[model samples]
Target: MLKKLVLIGGGHSHALVLRLFGNKPLSGVRLALITPDIYTPYSGMLPGHIAGFYSYSQCDIDLQSLSNFAHAQLCLDHVIGLDLKNRKVLCANQPTVDFDILSINISSTPTKLSVPGAVEYTIAAKPVAQFLEHWYQLQENAVRNPQKALNIAIVGGGDVELALSILAGVRKLEIYLFQSSKELMPSHHQSVRRIMRDILSNQDVKLHLGERVCEVVKLINKGLTIKCESGLMVTCDQVFWVTHASAGSWLKAAGIGTDDQGFILVNDNLQSVTHPHIFAAGDIAKMINYQLPKAGVFAVHKGNPLYENLRSMILGESLKPYKPQTAYFSLIVTGDGRVLANRAILPLPSHQLWWCWKDCIDRNFMAQSPHQ
Candidate 1:
């Protein structure tokens, strides 16, 4: 009897899994992929793309080609829910896909848009495809009305701030960053934070520290007013929410074991806690034994182990545990022709050479696809 293996979301881990499966096909196992888009953008090159250093085709993987190479049926649809009891995957537009084994590698979106008018006013810097639409429009507006000064307000103190700052510089727009915390990038080392602060400062971007947004009010003139808890209000033409990552609500609704934030709870082998037949990786998964940041590099690294375990499960073989490295090297593009290199709590100097290194690494990863 043949078993169906369904992979959801064309994320980095799933992309790698598809490539690996294509190279080493398994007999009697049919594969299918469910995703919303035919092109999956590489997070590493996103800033470069925004800065006009890379084109859209250069930064995104051709999922259609990759799926064809893997000999898997590509179902382009947005997943709405899962029929866990029936071992079926539900979609927004397509019919339910049945699978003996399933894996989810979907990305997360900002869910803290609880404030009034926030959802209607702010653009979440996730579901990258959607954001790119607004981004392109913003660029056009900037070019069309160069004299009118475009003001952009981004909420979040994470690595996103750095990339947005680069965009602000490239577009020559007035940018403001609002962070609830007093300091930026709490996960990074003091040195890295200091460097980021210095870089953002050099970019002439305004910073609003320790100011928690209370409400987002749309103005009659189609502008936005960001009111903070501290009674501070700032008016801007656009607001970008780049805050915390939240999993899809369908995970919780499907009765899957998830973290408090609704991210799937997975073991060392990347198998779902409640259902061994189901596996999860990438930002949507929360490792129960290890707390990992929702970073794409980690998801990319999980590809190998996840593929092995999935193949082993299909073959009725033993599964292997995947222990993430205690530390991984991080390269942050400085928006200019420079990059910042760091590892865990250690920070290195920023230089243009680092940018070259990062560009090479990102290109190599993209080149792994069947046809670039």
Candidate 2:
């Protein structure tokens, strides 16, 4: 009997695994993929897509086509639960699948905060598909009401929030970026953070730093109003929340060893501590040996390592450790065909040429995928 290899989610890591498995098939292994969407969106190209630099087709990885090439079964459904004891994965619209080995590359979802009305009114920017749809509607509304001044609030302190702001620059919309921290891009170095702040300042984007959002309430005349902990109420046409990326609720319920934030705890081999037969990658896996930022780049890099480990497990070979580099280059698009490259402390100015370079890189990644 062929050993069943089940992969949950069509994320970047899993996509690479499929490609690798396609090129180098493992004996007696039957591959399967479960995901809600056929096409997985690339986060790296999302900013460019939002900024009108690339089309939707240019950034999506087609899972159905990739699965065909890899000789894997594609289950187009959402994984609602996992039966770890039985080594079975429960789907929303499909029958449960039993697996000999399992891997997960599902991305994180925006965590619900203590703030009131945030869950009901604010739009989350993690589930890229839903966010993209909402953003498109907002763009359409703005185009129809070109004369009216629009007020948009992006609640986050990460690079994603900045990217959204840059993308929203297509319209003459009045954008406000609210960060609870004293500075933006809190994870970045001071110099890089300063440069980002300067970029936002130059763009005339309003910044409300050091003010935590306590609640969000929809006003009859003023769309959505966010009440800050500092006793300030901010009214905006729409609210975009890019804060807090948490793992799928199913992971916790499945009794997987997870952190407080719900990210699955995985060893260097990317296998769950409690369930060695089960593997995890992308934003869902927390590196046990090395701590790394939840960047798409890391997820992309994990593809090869995961592929090797999965093959090793099938062949009774020893697994290899996935050591992440301390620092990686970060390119920030400022929404005007300009990008900033942050290698270390200070970010180097990357003009149109850099944007073009980034565009080429993203396009190539999408093109290499079988789905594309």
Give the poorly placed runs of model 2, Cα more than 4 Å off. Answer: 160-169
Candidate 2, 21-99: lDDT as tens digits = 9888777999999998988789888887888877888888889989998999999898999887788999888799999
Model 2: how far is 219 from its true place, Å? 1.1
Clashes of 2: 0
Quality of model 2 by C-alpha lDDT: 0.84
lDDT per residue as tens, model 1, 118-222 = 789999888989988888888888888878877788888785534553464446577889889998887888899898898888777788989999899999999
Model 1 lDDT, residue 30, Cα = 95
**Lowest summed lDDT over 10 consecutive residues: which window, candidate 2?**
160-169
- The candidate maximizing lDDT is 1
- Model 1 scores worst on lDDT over the 10 consecutive residues at 161-170
Runs in model 1 with CA error above 4 Å? Answer: 160-170
Error of 1 at 310 (Å): 0.5
The candidate scoring highest on TM-score is: 1
